[model samples]
Target: MSLPEPRDPSGPYRISVVCLGNICRSPMAEKVLTGELDRAGLSGAVEVASSGTGGWHIGSGMDSRAAALLRAHGYPTDHAARRFDPAHLAEHDLILAMDHANLDDLRRLARERADIGDRLRLFRTFAPDAGPSPEVPDPYYGGEHGFTTVLDMVHAAAKGLTAELAARYGSAL
Candidate 1:
């Protein structure tokens, strides 16, 4: 079945954070964005989630390092890895990818479809500063510091995303 569209008319703003695998960046983005909107009193106004370009991590929990970093930062831990699908082009209004390869992969996956390329967006479009970056940088292989930096990036982008969506749809919904 297709993923449900977000319920908020203003929009649940269905967003799916995507990376090479769901264990690292995308999951962090999903959880971080969820928390950011909640703290901003914009919770449930957006349907936020995460996935991977590949299925390697499907059904796995967030990487232990990722989980620890999130807990360290006081974010939620509910996550399950899944692969990106073509139907996702319709499932989510926005898809934030972690890097150039994944963004290309996502678009390639939707090559037969129309409208999704526009929906597939860089994960950093919502960053609070530094203009924009090409990638969110995968943190699965490094130490806590890499994970921490990922946290910083996702957190920055989440706020910008929240504000932009709120502006278009009115955050009150």
Candidate 2:
């Protein structure tokens, strides 16, 4: 099978996982994917990060409970929130969004339709067994369990995503 290099060879091999807000879903996705890659011994080969659809939380660390949840799950929790940039449309090799609205936002930023063609996909599309969960729910306004739920979804999706990456970019892994 052919695996896509999650990262670009000419650069740091970056994968910018994105959601509506950096604090919750996207960061959770980042941690899960990064952790899965780490388990596969591709930690250094995969450069993972998270950003938001809006600028409200830029330069902020993930929520405290979110950090705790990540640690509880034994995944790295370090992240700084930032809004999605138009340049990101060109920067990231793959852009995984939590929902269709965010996908539309990313698509709207594309300078050309081909710029986003087949690149931006729903995160749940890669989930191992999360049935019909199109987007990981935002846990920011809810209680701690919401964060855990988000983590659960993120972890499953990250696993499938990593395996896909390995197949797509066999030489890199």
Candidate 3:
């Protein structure tokens, strides 16, 4: 289960965002990040997707609030919730967990894939001044404010992540 480095620099840089349920945080991150990359003119160079650590919401649509928030921000809201598969380690260049619990779950799923350490990271790790809290809080049970807050956090981190990707694969892109 060894997580390999970006297999081919000339190929698309794959990214997978994960959370407890694919409907909220993960889908928002996915759409926001994809929008950021497209705005950066790096959409062709990057492949962004998301999934949940659990299977409960598999095949469902993104949470309504989450979809609405993304729509308001001019981001796409077309995403089908899916559970993260172990095989994703071999497919994606990076796996971003929205919170510590999801991060831990991904790591546990990695099992003996010791080499995956470099590729497994918290989504907020890319945010500027993220402080000690590296989570993109779940907004499903909260009010509209919660969804907006998650959007802000996701937008900030998506910008950072896009910049990092552009720097790393600019020429190839």
Candidate 4:
């Protein structure tokens, strides 16, 4: 199925990127998407936030490797870890899960909401080169290269997502 239409074209199109631990993938995705949105000149019209399916790192800062990778690539590195709340379904236009497991977690959490299926999606769905793998791998325990790899994946998806949003709400931007 296709993505749902933007709910509030005139207002901010909110998005939430979710991963297993907020300290890693999701925060990186959030910064990349936000930076891409800002570069596309939709900074004020689109807002991107991030959280985790688990609450282990809630209130913690992003992993040093992630923050370094983002800053090295000219993206924002300011973010704190948070748990993905079910209430985010109401506040965000889209909720992108980094992996299928977390996507499943979000789907189960969103079971009570009628439009859950419409807003929830895999983050890598937007990446043209994402290929058969749809999940953004967790780099928490990996070496430095892993963080850079995640950054590359997030960057591609962020650009694609920005284009999609720009097409839908270019006038507002």
Candidate 5:
């Protein structure tokens, strides 16, 4: 799908990645996407952040497994968990949910602002080979292998999204 135009044309495009809790999938996708944007030379033209639909992990760091996997892959591991604020609908150019549940939460919060509908999408939708199911499965309750799997999925989606951003904004960069 085509990206929505920046809400504020002169400012960097803002993106918020969200999941059930800020400690896992969303933060992983956030850091991975940030790195991909940097690699694509669009880092300065875009801003990335992450939050959760639920408050369970609010104020905590990213899940240990997720942090370790990102560190091993050379991605930064600094993150402070926070809940997704409905006000973000006005602030972000795009809001990506890690799974359908989080998407539903975001959708409910956004019901009052119908104009922002185009900004919402599943994080995996950007992955070229994501197939029919685009949800990024939560790795919180699983073993190390689950984190590894999530990282791979995030990396693929990040690369695809970066390419699209570069195509649209590369000239300015």
Candidate 6:
């Protein structure tokens, strides 16, 4: 699917990545997408941020395993966990959820706001070869290999999304 138009035509396109908890998938996607956008020359044309559906981990750092994997891959892991505020619906061009559950939570929070609902989608949907299930699985309870697997998924999606952004903003970039 194509990306929604920027909420503010003259401003940088804002995107918010989300998951159950901000410590894992969402933050990883955020950093990977941010780096991809920078590499694609859309660094100043887009703004990326991340949050969680639940408030349990608010103000926490990235999960240790998640942080270590990102660091090993040369991606910055600095993050402050926060809950996704419904009010942010108007502040972003897109809201990407890491899995179906997070997407459902965002849609429920969006409620009657059709404009926001249109902007919400599964993050992995941007992956060029995303299979039948595009959801990025939660790696928190698994082994180190789970985190590595998640990074691979995030990297693929980030690259695809960045390509779309570059196409749309190439002239401006």
The global C-alpha lDDT for each of the candidates, from Candidate 1 onward, is 0.81, 0.78, 0.87, 0.87, 0.92, 0.92
TM-score, structure 4 vs. true = 0.94
lDDT of 6 by residue, 68-125 (tens): 9899888899999999999888899999999999999988888889777479999999
Shift of residue 103 alpha carbon in model 2, Å: 1.2
lDDT of 5 by residue, 135-162 (tens): 9999889999999999989999999999
Candidate order (lDDT) = 6, 5, 3, 4, 1, 2
lDDT of 4 by residue, 61-141 (tens): 999999888888887778778898888888888899999999999999988888765799899989889898878999989
Model 6 whole-model lDDT (C-alpha atoms): 0.92
* Model 6 deviation from the true structure expressed as Cα RMSD, one decimal place: 1.0
| Candidate 5 local Cα displacement, residue 24, angstroms | 0.6
- For model 2 the TM-score comes to 0.88
Q: Mind giving the per-residue lDDT tens digits that candidate 1 earns over 1-173? A: 12223434554668889899899999999998898778777776777878899998889999999998899889888888999887778878788898989999998888888655467778886775736465788987788899988888888888888777666656555
- lDDT of candidate 1? 0.81
Q: What is the clash count of model 5? A: 0
Mind giving the per-residue lDDT tens digits that candidate 2 earns over 1-173? Answer: 12334335755557778888798889888888888888877777668878989998888988898898888878778888999988887777778888888888887787475645677778877886767657877788999889888888888888887887666654464
Q: Least accurate stretch of 10 residues (summed lDDT) in model 1?
A: 1-10
Which residue pairs in candidate 5 collide?
Answer: none
Give me the runs in candidate 1 sitting further than 4 Å from their true place: 1-11, 171-173
Each model's total of backbone clashes: 1, 8, 0, 0, 0, 0
